[model samples]
Target chain A: MKVLIYGSGQLAQMMYLAAVPLGIQVSAVDVGNHTVVDPISKRSLELSIEDAIEQADVLSVEFEHVPEDLLEQAQSSGKLLPNSEAILAGADRVREKAVLSKLAIANSEHRIITQVEQLDEAVETLGDKLIIKASRDGYDGYGQWRLAHIEQLDSLKNTLSQLDLQNVPLIAEKMVPFERELSLVGVRGLQGDIQFYPLAENLHHQGQLHVSVAPAPDITENLNQQAQLAFKKLVEEYDYVGVLAVEFFQVGDSLLVNEIAPRVHNSGHWTQQGTDTSQFENHIRAITGLPLGNTKAKGKSAMINIIGCDDYSTDLLSIKNCHLHLYGKTVRPKRKMGHINLTGKTYSELAEVMTTLAKFLPIQAFPKLLDEADKLAAID
Target chain B: MKVLIYGSGQLAQMMYLAAVPLGIQVSAVDVGNHTVVDPISKRSLELSIEDAIEQADVLSVEFEHVPEDLLEQAQSSGKLLPNSEAILAGADRVREKAVLSKLAIANSEHRIITQVEQLDEAVETLGDKLIIKASRDGYDGYGQWRLAHIEQLDSLKNTLSQLDLQNVPLIAEKMVPFERELSLVGVRGLQGDIQFYPLAENLHHQGQLHVSVAPAPDITENLNQQAQLAFKKLVEEYDYVGVLAVEFFQVGDSLLVNEIAPRVHNSGHWTQQGTDTSQFENHIRAITGLPLGNTKAKGKSAMINIIGCDDYSTDLLSIKNCHLHLYGKTVRPKRKMGHINLTGKTYSELAEVMTTLAKFLPIQAFPKLLDEADKLAAID
Candidate 1:
């Protein structure tokens, strides 16, 4: 079957690779070029976006930021999965908050604001230390405004007023003093059979994922169950039929929903080497109405993102438990260039290798280096 | 750089897949097609054999059965490795015996015969029960004659006399009652840097690899060391500069060399999901002069070949810790269609998975099914 994915990024590239072995043809829409690139055929062709949408058996997105008009067109084609509604919830902070609140899921209290005048009430209700997020087109720390005090709120409010919040809307939420961040990636088939991967502890630097360790360390059984329940609730509530990633902030024994991603996610990269079914393959299975695959961990695995750097220590390969995966992307500053996957017999052993890896990886380029190091060291 | 492989089978296909992520171009010579096919580019073109050899950066074979003329031409290009000399040793039973004897490697006693008249001496030297094998183009139980008793030796000799043994020399060997079969897959670079993957315990059915377990079970430290030493000796002795797989018969604590494969072998398939570096990727690195990757096992892993039939239990994907890798080939009887990989916290867990997989797989087509079942059950 033919699958069409929106956005031609590393995720799309990997998904393309996964699909090929299953004899599934995958084509990607380069949103920048408004053209389609057949990953298997390596053939580029110009076609109307609607025609491409109609031609594919399934339409999915690599990320949540596809233009709404194209998504609407794809929805009209009756093939867009997790569907535009689910993707919109992920794309817009307001919709995401509403979905969480509607499901009685814990999240930071927030107010949807469209104009600068509303910022006064937002700050009064949400408090001085707050996070202002554009409801659309924001990722990797972009389109976010953080206020540390009341005095800074005025300038932030003015900055927000100057932007086109009228077109996108905004979410001003109280800053959460989270102890750590974790994520639950689950797949839901069309038959509503859902499979949840173990919660993954994630460390981010500069708002981009730097490292993800499967079966998050020191996680209380109660809190992990809560996260899985919240994830299941969201998937069933939305009738989501693909992999859904729910980001959470751990506070003592409780977890608060931080965000939701309606497709295969970065935090789940460890599954490629650690799990029986990789998130990419499971996503394909979920979307194709095939049986959801086993999500059990193969071993303790840690994934280190190779951000914005083309040159990596080939010597990492010399380490006893490191697997280097270089995404075929031209390196650019702060861009996700590739990642290294290290699997070991135990979490502590994996952590030790991660420590060795940090020595060779540039800390400035990868913001979560110290955090990743600490997590690995603390795994025991 | 462009690499041209001499055979278009699953190994070459996998190599092509691995090369794509590295942005390397790969084309394969399909002996069946008598032409070259670009695996990724999916472009098929005809060219004079000489032109194809000259166009490649290096020439390698997927199997050892390349026509003598083609081997000579490729060797004349001065890029064939581990060289025609090493390949001939694998291809010709006579040459293989000579190499083993010269190296003082432990192998079954054997004699070469060019005519039926020599059979009486061969029988006397080797024993009553003898295996007569053609020196060239014999694999998977083909091109061999068996003598169960001394009385039958003359009839076998008479039957062999009808053929021109001069044109096709045969090697007679005493049957070995090996305890188990094992293999060590290692890679050597031109600069003499070497890396060894852990020894693998292999179970074959119908003369085909049915299942392979990494870090061979019940392996004593001394035996493991001996296997590694033997592998190092063979690779260094041959000046091998690519992946060399040395098969052995583990009789008690000792290992008798069975044969050597100059390229990636089936027993190493567990590396795909079990190792820090897959054999396919490491072969490319060793051949390309890149730094060798770590050969550490991700976990205790078992690889089960999906032979003959195309249909197998997709249910294996539902079981925890199972990876289904289909080769995207149309299935036919006795054809190697694909394989499944299972990785677990321990060997016993891997064995459990292998047993569970066997129930879903058609063991009748593969001769080693019962042995695989026993091995899986012995995982503890």
Candidate 2:
């Protein structure tokens, strides 16, 4: 089978790696350059986008922020998985909130704004201290505004007025004081059979995933069920046919939907070594209509992201149970370079390994560094 | 770091997968084709044996049967890990016996013969009913002769005399009735630190590994320790660096060395999903002077080879805790196509997954079919 992946990035590279062993050929298109290249052959194939789509058994995107025209054209080929509706919901916060609301899932109360004048009503309805987000092309703390006070809301709205809100709308949401963030990575097949990986507790630094621990330590069975139910509702509503990552905020015993990623999410990286089937492979299986694999956890696993820095302390290799994965990416500041996965039979043992990993990681970015250090040092 | 692998097969392909994540470049040359190719690029590059030797950071082989000239060239490079001496001992039965005798390792008593005249003395020294084997280029039940009676010995010797035994001698050995077969796959670094994976109970069909279960079932702790000690002794004796898989036979309470593979062996495939560090990554680490990885078994694992068939029962995918890994090889009869790795908390659970896998695997070979069925049904 041949798969055409839009966006030539690390995720696409990894997908290519997973596809190869399945005897699937994957070709990538760099939408930025409008060039199609075979990842394995490193051969530049001069073909029209229509020809590429015509040849592919499936058309997919590495990121949801693909050009709408390209997605529409690809969709016209009747080969795209997770389809344009799913991508739109992932790319636009307004559509995402609407989807959640339609499903009656718990989310932060929010209103959409097409102009600066709507900010007054948004603040009145949601709150004075609100997060004003651009509906599309927003990620990693970009294209968003924070209103600390009612006086500041006007200036934030005024600043937002200069941009073309015609192409993109604004979503102002009430900020919730959540204890911690968690995510559920689940796959739904074309047959509507849903498989949920264990919920993962995620830690982010500067709006990028830094660390994720699977089975989310101290999670109650009821909460897990609730989360899974919420995920199923969203997947069924979308008629999703691939992996969907639903980010959540744990407010007391209840969880609030934070966001949804249409494709495999970084928070599920722990599943690569922790679960019987990796999220990447499961996503491919779900999209291809293959039987869903075992989602059982192998052990307690933690994944630490290697962000921005290309060079990491090779000392991490010295850690007995750690598995380092470096994406073949050229380094840049704040960019996700790769990740390290550590597995242990016990949660505390895995925590110890993560503590050792934290030292080799950029300490400042890892919020639990000091606590992890104290805990690991105490063990010795 | 760059590694030059001598054989191009599934093992080399897996090693390539593991190396890429570590940013290690592996260039492989198939001895059969005598052509070098970069696994990642899939590009065939013309390289003389001398140039390959000169350019490599370390030299290793996926299989033991590399040509003597190429082994000598690799050894002359002064960068061969586990060295030609170790590899030669593995490739030739005569050399292996000599090494075992010198090390005082328990092995079947054997005699080497260069001429048909030696057959009379060989039978007198060993036995009339003996296993006669070509000293080199023999594997997977090939290049071997079995004599049931005295009258058959002369005819076998006469047939053997037609071959050029000048380059390849023959070894006649007394057969031992063993309880079961086991293997220890371990690694030794240049720093002399060694890490041993848990002993594996192996099952072979037609002299090729069919399945391997790690932390060998129903074994005493003392026996496991003895196996580890034996493996350590071999590693130290060879001054071996990189992974070494030593096959053993259990007779009563004692273990005898059967054969050794100087590189990663097929029986260690369970490590892919059942260990903290896989054999492939650890081999790269050991040879590259990187710190040895943890080899602790995560759970009970069973690896079943998918040989000679491309179409398998997809129902196995529905089995919990079963992980299928197809090597992307174009199908052919009697060829190792891929393998499935099954892991569970208990041997019985792993056996259950194995049973499900057996139904999917095309059981063309009688020995494999019977053994798999028996293993599956006996697991209750």
Candidate 3:
């Protein structure tokens, strides 16, 4: 079977690796434009988007932010998985917020603003401390602004008034004091059968993900049930198919929905080491109408992102149970060049392995990792 | 770093899959003649073998039976890993027996016959009941003859004299009444570091491997130590620098060395899902001078060969913890198409899963699977 992916990135490359063992061919379109690159071959072909889409048994996106025209064309072929609406919902904050509201799921308090004048009311209604996100094309701390006080609104409004907001409205959210961030990566098959990897605890640096520990160290039955309920509601309502990653903010005992990624998310990378079948294989299985694989975790796992550093050694493999997955990318500051997944028989062992990993990573790019190591050390 | 493999078969393809995630490009040379084929691209390129060897950072063989000229050429490059001698040892039964005797390892009582007349002494000295094998290019059940009694030896000598035994000599052995067969797949790094996976119980049909169960259900520390010690002797003597699979025959409480494969062998396929890091990845690491990953088994495992069968369903994936690996080869009777690796948290659980797998497999191709399932059922 052949699968076509919208983005020729690490996610697609990983998918290619997972699919090949199962006799499936995964081809990725650069989405940087029209051209399909077989991630396995790293070979690019001058193929039209339509031609590529037509060749696949199923069409899926690595990221939700694929071009609307391409999504529309793929949808027309009836091959687009998770559907265009689900992708748009993930791409735009407004659609995402609406979807959460319809499911009666808890999210940060927010209001939509289309003009500079509405910013003043949004500040009053939501709060002075707010996060303003552009409804579309926003990610990794980009296309967003933060407000700390009422007095700051005018300058922010003055800066905003220079541009028209009607085309791209702002989702003004009242910042909440939360405990920590978590993400649940779940796959819903075309038959509507659902399976989820254990929720992964996420740590972000400069608004980009740095590291993730799966089965999120301090999880409870209640926490798992809460995430499952939200996932069930959203997937059922949208008739969702394929992996959907939901980011959450934990406040006291309650979990608030933060964002939805309509494709495989980085937080779930630990599945490569910790689960019976990885999230990539499950996503491929889900999207291709194959039976969903077992999501049973084999052990505790930590996935630390290798940001911008290509000089790292495979000496990390010397650390028992540490597995390195290097994405073939040119080095650039803060870019996710690769990730190392460390698995252990127990959480403490996993934590110890992560602590050892922090030694090999640059302190400048891995302060969070160091801090996490310290916390794990305290427990030890 | 790039790795050039000697064979463009399924083993090279799997190594290609494992290496790509570690940012390594593996170019496979179809040793049937001189040609380099990128297993992933499925594209063949006509390149000079010398240029290919020089281009590779490391050279390794997928199988041990490459042509001597090719091995010699690769050897001169100072890159052929595990070395040409190691490859030749695996290829010829005579050399293999010599290595075993040099290590003082036990083997079935055998005599080398360079001439047909040696058959007369072989029967008188060794025993009447004997199994004779051509020292080179013999595999599965081919290139073999049997003499049940002394009277039969004259007829066997008469039959053998129909041809010459100059280039291809025979190893005639007094057949041992063995209980079962077992194999140990171990990797030796450049730094002399070594790790061994637990012995795998193997079942053969028509002298071709059928099914293998790791941590061999009935195991004693003595049996494990014996295999490890023999492995240590063989690898140390050769200064081996990659995965080596040693096949053994069990006689009462003792184990006799049957054979050694100098590359990733079919018996180690269980490591793909059963261990922290697979034998293929470890072989890649060993040759590249990278740190070896852990060989710790994640669980009990069974690897059933998918020989000559392409009509198998992915429904095997529906079986919990079952992983399908198709070689993408055209079906032919007795050809190794691929394998399925099934893992479980315990021996009993693994037995149950293997039992379930037997249902999906053709009885003709997998009688051992049925027998194993019946045994497991009896235990249940």
Candidate 4:
């Protein structure tokens, strides 16, 4: 079996690793070069995209932001999993918001603005405090702006006017006050069987996910059901196949949709060590029509992203259940170099491991570690 | 970091998978051709063996029977883990028996026969029922002859006389009646730290391992200690680094040394899902001078080898906690095609999953499944 992935990055590399033991060969298209490459070695496979597509048993994407032309090429092969509609829902905020509205799913009060003057009306209707985002190609806090107050609307509009708003519209979303962010990472098989990893509490630093604790502490049955229901509705609506991540904001008792990622997600990386089957493996299984492995969590887990720093001592592996997954990429500021997954019997135990792990990493590179560790330590 | 393993087989392929997540690249020596190749893809790397040896941070082997010239070349690089002596001990029965005797390890009462005339003395001193084995390149019940009764001793001697015993001597021993065969798969780090996975009870059909249950049922504390003590003594004596498996024959309350493998063993495949870290990953960690991950078992596990068969339905994956690991090998009689790992909270649960799994696999291919399931089902 062979799987071709659209984006050649860490996610594809991970999928390749998971797929190998299942007798599946995974080749990735370096969307940057539009050439097929080995996901791990990044070596050109010397095969054209057409050849790869034809040879693959399934086609998938590592990220939602794959170039449209390339995605179309993959989708037209009739092997693409999750379908192009699901991928586009994650790629374009406008399409995503439309799906949420059509499904009557709870999300932030938002308006799509194609013209500059519409920002004023968005502010008036939604709120003065809003997060304005580009409809496409927005990721990791890029292509976004904040309207903190009514006073900044003119300045924000002036900044936004530099772009062709007609070509790419803006999504002005009311910034809802929420307890914290949680992401439900789930997979839907070809047979419509769906399974979810426990909701993970995500910690963001500078609009990038820094750490995630799975089976987020203090989650009530009501909250879990709400998240799962939203996930079910969205996947079923798209007839989605493969892994989908729905990021949400817990506003008191309800979860509001923040975003959806149509691929294996960072927040669910803890599943590599925390669950019986990782999200990567599950995604491959779902797309390839294999029976999905168990999704049950083995224990509490914390996935701490190793951002932009490779200087940390490998001795941190001495920490029990601390597994390092390095991306084998050159260090660059804010690049997701890799992640450390730690598992424990309880949140407090996970916290202790995180605290110990923090000592081995550069503090500046992992700004959220100590704080998240402190928060989790107080839980039990 | 890079690791070059001798013998491009399933073991090396699995090590490649485990090593990738640690930012390590693993290449394999197709010892048969003496060419370096990608462990998983088996693609020619276009690199010479010497170049691979020089580039790798560590060198190891997938199988004990690597050609002597290749082992010597690897040892000359000063990068080989477990050293050459440890590997040679595993490759030759004579050397292995010598090492056991020197370490005062309890093994079978045996006599080395470099000439055919010694066979008659072996039968006079020991029992009439004896198993004779070639000292080198013996595996999977091959290169062996059985002397079932005093009357058959002359015939067995005639069979043995046909071989060049002077070059590859034979081990003639009384066939001791044992309760079961168990293997202790353990790893030793460069820093001399050691950890062991729980002993696995192996089931053989026609001398090929068809099933293995880890943390074997009905184990007493004393038996476990004896196994661990033997393992510690052997590894320490060799000053070994990387994973080593010591096979034992449990007789009454004691365990006698059967053989030792210098690399990861088949019985430990259950670690892939049933332990905090697998034997493959631990071997990588050990050779790379990294701290070893926890060796604690997560639950009861059974690993069923998919021998010479690829005709099973993958729906067995629908069984909770069952994971399929296919080696992507073309089926050949007695070939180890892949393995399925099933984990459960207890023996009974593991047995139930095994029973369900049997429905998906060919009965002839898995001769031990139903019987082992019955045994485990009666355990708890």
Candidate 5:
């Protein structure tokens, strides 16, 4: 089967690699801005995007942010996997929050703010502390504002009022004091069969994902059920087909939905090394109407993002059980260059590998890994 | 670093997949014919072969049979891994027999034959029952002839004498009535560190590899030692770098060298799902001077080659612990389509999965699977 993917980035590159061995041909739009250079050969193509898409058996997105017109074209063709509506829901916080509310699923308490006056009422109803996020065009902390106290709401409102909030409204949420952050990465097949990877504990730095440890340490039955329950509701409601990642904030024993990513996620990267079938492969499988692969965890795994570092010594691979995935992207500060997946027979072993890996990394390039490594060591 | 591979086939494609995550660029010559279509994009390239060669940091062969001239050019550059001499030894049975003799290794009692007149002497020295193999360009039972007794030798001689045997000679061997076939897949790094995967029990049908069970059932310390000793001899003698696969015939308490492939072998495919690192990754690692990865087997694994069929339902992936690797090639009779690597917690579990898989496959496509399944069931 042939697959056409929207947004040719590192995620698309990985999907391309994963799809090839399955005998599934994958081509990406906007990869060469229509010229479709082979990702491996670095050679330009003679095929046009029209021909590429027309030949594709299925259309999917590598990320949530493909332009709407192209998405509409794919949608009209009725070949889009997971559908454009689901992609839009992930792209827009308002729609995602509404989906959560409509399903009666637990999530952070929030109120949409369209005008400056609504911020006052949002503060009055929600709490003193707030996380104000733009409904659209926001990710990795961009277009997001946090309110530590009600006193700062006016300043935030003043800053927000200058921007045109008509088309993109703000979601003012009461920041919950959660015990930890976790995510469930799962796939929904065309037959509506759902299979979820074990919950992964996530660590964030500067509003970007820094690390993910799978089969999250000290997971309780209660937490597992809650995440699965949330996942079931989302998949069933959307009739979703393809990989969907749902981030959650664990408040004590209760798990509340944080947001959903309709594509393969970084938090699920651990599955590449930790599971029999990776999330990337499962995503392709689901999109192409293949049965979902087994999601059984092989062992404990930790994935540390290689953000903005080009200085990674190939020698780092010399370390036992350390797998490096470099994205081959030009290094820019805060960019996700790639990640290192360290798997072991136990949490302690993974921790030990992580600690050793930290020693090899540049402190500036790895802003959050050292601290995460320290936590893993403590766990060890 | 950039890697240039001699052959552009499934091995090169898999190597391409394995190397991408390591941030290494691999360009394969002779893959898309002289055009060198990018493996990832499947598009023709604009670059010249010389430019591709000059851009490469290391040159390696996906198979031993690369043209001698190309091997000479790569050898002159001093960038070839495993080197041309090792490849030539693997290509020519005479050279291989010489290496075995030099290393004092055990092999089938044999005599080189350059003329049809030598058959009678070979029979007198060896035995009536013999296996004769071509010295060059032979695989999968091709370029082979067999003799059951002296009476049959006349007919074989009549047929053999009609062909020119000047350049390419044959090796006439007394057919050893032993046990099962096995292969040792191992790697030697540029730093001289060597790692060997456990022996794999290979099952052949019509002289083609059908299935391989890794950490071969009923292996003992003596058998393991014998294989490792032979490996040590070959690696040390050649000062080899990159993966080498050696096929062996088990006879009682002894093992005889059958042949050697100076590149990753089909027998190592189980490593994809059954080891912390795969043979493909190790090959790239060894060539690029990266540290050799762990060769520890994960539980047990069996790999079944998908030959001459593309009707392989992706649903086979639905089987637990089963991973399919399809070569993106046109379907043809007797062509190796791809392979399925099934990993399990025990020999019994792997056996069970294999048996279950056999039921789903066409009988024509899987001649040995049902029998292997039955054996596995008995073991279970």
Candidate 6:
């Protein structure tokens, strides 16, 4: 079986690693250059994009932000799993909000704005406290502005007016005082069967994910059902096949949809060490029309992103149940170089491992480690 | 870091898979032609053998039977782990027996025969009930003969006289009635730290391993200690620094050494899904001078080889905790195609999973499945 993934990044690399044992060959596309490459070595394969698509049994993307022209070409092949529509919904915030509204899925109250003048009415309707975002190509806290008071609205509009709003548009969301950030990573098989890994609590620093803990502590049964229900409605509506991630904001006992990612997600990386099957493997199985492997967490696991630094001691592997996954990339500030996965029987045990891990990592690069470790340690 | 392995087969392929995440790149030598190739795709690399050797930080092997010339070349590089002496000990039964004698390790009662006339003395000393083997280039039940009575001696001598006994020699052994076959797979690190996975009970069909159950049922503390003691003695004797396999025949409460493999063995494949660290990764770590990962088994597990068949239903994955590892190979009678790994919390549970797995496999390809499953199910 041949799977052609559209992005030659860490996710594609991981998918390639997971696919090999199942007798699947994975070739990755360097979207920046339209060159096909081996996911591990990034060495270009002697094949054109058209030839790769022709030979592929299935076509998928590692990220939602793949170029539209490439996505359209892949869609024309009739082998793209989850389809381009689902991917577009993930890429465009306006489309995502529309999908949630169409499915009657609970999410944050937001309004689409295609003009700079719309910001005044957004503040009046969503109150002065709002988070305004670009409708497209915005991620990791970029292309966003915060409105803490009515006085900041004019300046935010002025900043937004510097760009062509009508082309990409904007989403003015009420800044919700959510209790915590949680995400549910699930896969929908070709037969329409869905399996979900337990919710993972996500910790972010400077708008990038730094750490995630699976089977997030203090989760209520109702919260889990709410997350799954929203997930089910969205995947069913799109006839989605493959892994999809839905980020959520918890308010009291309810979960409000924060965003959706139509790919194997970073929050699900914990499954590599803490579950019967990983999300990457499940995604491949879903696209290949195979049975989805188990998604149940075997134990509590924490995934700590190795961002912007590779200076830490590799001896951290000496810790029991600790595993490192380096992406074989050179370091750059805030770049997601790789990640560390630690599994333990309890949240406290995971925290202890994380604490030990923190001692080996530079605190400046991993800003959320100590705080997240403290929170997990306090869990019963 | 880079690792170059001799023998481009499934073991090398698996090592490549395990090494990628550790930021280690592995290239394999197709020993048949001295070509360096990608272990997964088997594509010939752009580099020559000399260049590959120069680029590799460490050299190793996936099997002990690599040709002597290649072994000598690797040894001269001073990068080969376990050393060529250890590998030669595994490849030549005569040298292996010498090592056993030097270390005072208990083994089968046997005599080395360098001439056809020595067979008469071997028969007298080992008795008529014997198993005779070529001292070199023999494996997987090949190059062996058995004698059930004294009446067969003259015919065996006539058969042996037609060959060059002086070059290869022979090992004539008294065939003992053994209760079971068990193998201990372990790794020795750079600093001489050793770790062993629990012994695995092996079941063979036509002298090829068909199934292996790890943390073998009915193991007493004394049995485990003896296996580890023999392993420690051999590794320390050679100053070995890689994964090694010690096969044993259990006679009453003692273990008699059957043979040793200088690289990852088939019996240790169970570690891929059943333990915190797989033998492949540990071997890489040992050669790269990194700290070894955990070796403790997570639960009772079984590894069933998929030999000479691809007709089984992939739906076996629907069986919970079951994983398929298909080595991309053309089917041929008696050839190893791949394996299935199943893990469960108890012996009975693993048996139940194996029974479900058996329903999806052809009986001819998995000759020992039902019997082994029955045995495991009967365990308390």
lDDT per residue as tens, model 3, B84-163: 98899999999999999988998888999989988878888998989999898888888888888777877888877775
Q: Would you list the clashing residue pairs of candidate 4?
A: none
A-chain TM-score, model 1: 0.95
Q: Give the fraction of reference interface contacts each candidate recovers.
A: 0.46, 0.65, 0.81, 0.92, 0.87, 0.86
Q: Which scores greater on TM-score, model 3 or model 6?
A: 6
Docking class of 4: high
| TM-score (0 to 1) of chain B for each candidate | 0.93, 0.92, 0.96, 0.99, 0.97, 0.99
Q: Model 5, range B1-380, lDDT digits (tens) per residue?
A: 89988888899889989999998988788743665545554454567667878888998988898877778888988888988999999999999999999999999999999999999899988989999999998998899999988889889999888767888999998899979998999999998999999999999988899999888888899999999999989988888999999999999999999999999999999999889889999999999999889899988898899988877566678789988898888899889989999887877787788877876777688887777766765664
Ranking by TM-score: 6, 4, 5, 3, 2, 1
Measured by lDDT, the strongest candidate is 6
Encode model 2's per-residue lDDT on A227-263: one tens digit a residue. Answer: 9989988877778888899999999999999999998
Query: Which sequence of candidate numbers ranks them by DockQ, best first?
Result: 6, 4, 5, 3, 2, 1
TM-score of chain A, cand. 4: 0.99
Which ten-residue region of model 2 chain B has the weakest summed lDDT?
B365-374
Candidate 5 C-alpha lDDT tens digits along A259-350? 99999999998888899889999999999988889898988999989887778677888788889887888899889999999998777787
Q: Kindly report which residue stretches of model 4 are placed more than 4 angstroms away from their true locations once superposed.
A: none
What's the lDDT for residue B203 in model 6?
94
Clashing pairs in 6: none
Chain A TM-score (model 2) = 0.93
Local distance difference test values of all predictions, in order? 0.80, 0.80, 0.87, 0.93, 0.87, 0.94
Chain A TM-score relative to the true structure, per candidate: 0.95, 0.93, 0.97, 0.99, 0.96, 0.99
Deviation from truth (RMSD, Å), model 3: 2.0
For residue B168, model 4's alpha carbon misses the true position, in angstroms, by 1.0
Off by over 4 Å in 5: A31-43, A370-380, B31-33, B40-42, B378-380
Instruction: Please list all clashing residue pairs in model 1, or write none if there are none.
Output: B205-B367, B205-B368
